[model samples]
Target: MRRILIVGAGQAGLQLALGLQAQDYDVTVMSNRTADEIRGGRVMSTQCMFDQALQHERDTQINFWESQAPRVQGLGVSVAAPDGSRAIDWLGHLDHYAQSVDQRLKMAGWLETFAQRGGQLVVHGAAVSDLDFFARTYDLVLVAAGKGELVSMFARDAERSPYDAPQRALAVAYVHGLGPRPEHPDTEAVRCNLVPGVGELFVIPCLTTSGRCDTLFWEGVPGGPLDVFRDIKDPAEHLATTLELMEKFLPWEYARATKVELTDAGGTLAGRYAPTVRKPVGRLPGGGAVLGVADVVVANDPITGQGSNSASKCAAAYLAAILEHGDRPFDEAWMQATFDRYWETARHVTTWTNAMLAPPPEHVVNMLGAAGELQPVADRFANGFNNPADFEEWFYDPAKTEAYLASVTG
Candidate 1:
């Protein structure tokens, strides 16, 4: 039996462990902290798993996704322009889709599944100084240390652009007491607004510990109206600043949900909200190979909510590669095939969404006004996000995007 050691028991690591164990590989997962520690601690991040990814979970493991559907079935999204003007209802594009549970719960559930299947979990305290020991011990070692820690591993090979500039830091709050669906609720779905020279504000529904739905949200683009709240030490002020910013940038929805309360709501979610962090796919100088996934490699402005979905898709592909090449060294060919497959798969959608959030191109603005024609294009684009293989087959193929563009435009 092949022995494998996976570092970082977060989403990708846990998912890989479960898949490999089912294939009957000798698998052990090591994380810097215990499962309870990771679950109870850590600043909460939002994760949205699409229908396809959920189905992947179901197809792979019988009970995997079945446990989380209450939170996954109905997903809603919308776009708000600077003046609080509405674009096409983003929910329409997502009505056919399903979402996943919070990141922490999702990871915990999967980790438990891995353990039940005869996999081992070791909580290795912060930092593993050497991989040579592990390389000798296990048939393969997978690293998925998220955001900040993963950056250094890819510093040398990445090309940086101004778009990489962290235009704004994000302040997210996971709040409760937001009452379960008011009779005439503001918007029936998640809300996103673009405040011209200011920043973007996004509020989406999430599940609370009470099992009632509340919102896991963020106020974006750090330099504008809420800049004063940037460095505050007070939790109340942090929540206050988010409220103030929401009122200014997203008045309609804010007005509708004024009475909703906030929990652990406040200050910058990350001290520095925005910084350009993109790295090339390759190995670390210390010898073990590492490929950046999700926010680590493709940290884009969260204005699109594509971060988690994108990460999950990349992870699924990565998992598939490991299962197929059993006992084979994860060599340069496998690495390139896997990493480049992710890049080729995700690059277009990532780029297109980034462009939408950036200073809008005139053509895009014009295209939005005639949304009747653009709606189907928007739906397909949103659906395509779930699986990149489908995307390449439909949009990125030599002449497909042009045809797709024409069909939407006409």
Candidate 2:
């Protein structure tokens, strides 16, 4: 059996390890925290996985929370106006429902499941030196956790990475009691409110350790008024600040947020990371080569909410690559080729996500405006979240946007 060591226990690493285990390969996973620690830790993200991404989880049989989580049927976009009204508002229905499960609940459960299946679990913080030693014993070592010094092993791909600083100061609070949009009270949806230069707010329905709840997230333009979570030491204070900003910039959303409370003491989170694409292979000091996985190689900002989905796809793609390689040595050439294959799909996501960090071109703005008047345009935009690659078909180009709008409106 081919021996593989997967480092990091986030969505990608754990998913890949579990997949390999199911294949009956000799697989071992290293996690920095025990399942208990992860279960007790703060929420990791507002991971709302659309159809394709969710399908990857189902294919692997790890989607344990699907039955309990809220089914987000569509996504609504409202451009906030200076007069406290919506300048442009529309809700685009997704063909398939998306769902979010707190990482605390999912990761911990996955960690235990991996062990229950007889897969070796190493509960230790892995360093470069540790990998160098492990490489001598394991036929392949893959880095899935992007945090810590392990990230330094992958060189930044400057050509593909467009930003050096975080585009947004991100903050999130998992809460209970968030009411649905008044107009769509009977429907569950992901609400995205854009405050022009200020930034964007996302209200996502999710399932947490405490059961059904919502994630109120803010992606504040750096140094903007909403980028004020730096000193928040209390979760209640964080929720209050989130509410204050909502009241000022998104009164309609605040109308429903007034009575919401944090889901738990560790339910609030604040941080930011620049979007970057790194070389696929991580080199160790001992000349051992390890492959970087998912966010370790292509870490995009969560503004587009593609992080978890990208991770799931990355794991699935890599699993296929590994299986196909058979007994062949997992060399640098193979590692680069595997990543290149995944990038065929990921590049589209990268392009669309990076474009969003900048001011939308007039043509792009026009398309969004047109979406409000046309259901086809709205549905296309909504489903693009499931397949961001579709945006290149009509979203980015002025000519194509014009042609598409004309086709739908006429």
- Estimated TM-score per prediction? 0.81, 0.99
Question: Global lDDT of each model?
Answer: 0.58, 0.93
Off by over 4 Å in 1: 62-91, 126-128, 148-150, 160-164, 177-188, 227-229, 263-268, 271-295, 372-410
Lowest lDDT sum, 10 consecutive residues, model 1, at 68-77
lDDT of 1 by residue, 18-59 (tens): 777878889988777665664565445655556666665665
Candidate 1 C-alpha error for residue 410, in Å: 6.5
Model 2, span 49-114: residue lDDT tens: 999999999999999989999899999899998999999999999999999999999999999999
